[model samples]
Target: MRELVFALEYEPGCNRVADALADHPDARVRSLSLHATAEQLWRVDHATGTPDALDAIEDAFLTSDYYADCLATEDCGATQTTRVLDRTDDTLVLYSDWERTPSCASVPHIARDHLGESVLFETRHEGRHYTWRLIHSGEGDVAAFFDALEVAVGDCARMEMLRTADTTASVGGSDETQSGLSPEQEAALRAAVEHGYYESPREVDVGELAEHLDVPRSTLTYRLRRAEEHLAKQHVADERLPEDPSATR
Candidate 1:
């Protein structure tokens, strides 16, 4: 199997959902499930953020056009419907189903055209960036897909190919594990460690670190806290003892 990881950076006003996320940098949306066909697309997404951010996201998804690739300027004869399956103080589970028209440009349709129907997709959205991971049985027409995607996006967004490798070769082991940190979280943690922010004599404060990273202090703090939380949980899991001690034997 082969894996392709890519990301799209949307320009302002390109996509309403993306713009909403950009407005609330602390909010993140992850695909819990997604399935697409030539005629329709169905997806379930999990979002986490403050109540206001979640509200904005839910509103955006419901009120805006639901083109998976981006926003559609002209009516493509498509229709979208959304539902809030669950909600909490800081999380939301959303479900959406959209009917597609031939004129509609979406990642699933493009992938089906080039990558075949055997491909699996996973996606995450944060700020103005949408990242995708695809796994397919064969190599597929990657170049053609990229070209087609670029044309579809027009001048609204930039597409980047992050990685492409054989799944078997990349799956197994790594010398340094991140304990499930997202790219943003990893960056925050790395910067903090390098700047001696964790040292007893604290070389830099949170505000200073945020300035160095060129991000808002609140955003930096959120990333750091999330990263630390993941690391702590991972450490506890690793050190956990089996309920039945004889299992070690």
Candidate 2:
């Protein structure tokens, strides 16, 4: 079984959160957890129910054909829960005590209907095209699972996989083969330099960089620091490599 961590973007104006975040580009959603059912738990930065901020979100819920329920606020740390109705054979029935009674609105139900019930949704991006970390147990037909996902996302939703990797504890891949750092670490440095984030005046701040990179500020900062440290050490090593006695006449 393999775990696929990827990014995807959906058609805007199709969902409450997607529309809300689209209207407010500066604000974004991160740290998402999608359950076995359609219920999803996610945190949106700075979308604390202000009229202009959540206008799209409220409008979507009100007009959606599917029955929907929302709980949002600063006290809630800017979180939202979406449940959509399903009347097909894929309808989900929750057996876990930790889960809410089976609801029609859960997105995971799409996967559950066709991909078996062991799928996991770890992280997500809430922009025009939503990004997510979807983990499947590999117990079902992989091809069918994705096909079902596309249907659930709707024809208007645009989705794609950003990257794929097998499950293991450490981060080892092509990046480590060519360089000592992981791919994410290298990306962090690139993002920092590309946006002039390292300039004296700093055109972009760490928070903005984090939002753009779809990672937490601390995560972004750590990767950059680690990448820089790897580079610095490599520089010192490269300079000293030729000083050995083997290089002397």
TM-score against truth, every candidate: 0.72, 0.47
Candidate 2 lDDT score at position 68: 22
lDDT of 2 at 86: 21
* lDDT, model 2, position 2: 55
lDDT of 1 by residue, 190-213 (tens): 999999999999999999999999
lDDT of 2: 0.52
Superposed model 1: Cα runs more than 4 Å off: 66-71, 171-249
Clashing pairs in 2: 9-129, 10-129, 38-106, 38-107, 83-105, 84-104, 84-105
State the lDDT of candidate 2 residue by residue for 1-249, as single tens digits.
456544445444455666665666544434323454444433222223334545554445445433222211112222334433222232211111122233332345565666567777655434454545556665766567667666555554655543444566344433253465667776888899999998999999999999998976645655676578778988887788657676685
Q: Give me candidate 2's TM-score against the actual structure.
A: 0.47
lDDT of 1: 0.80
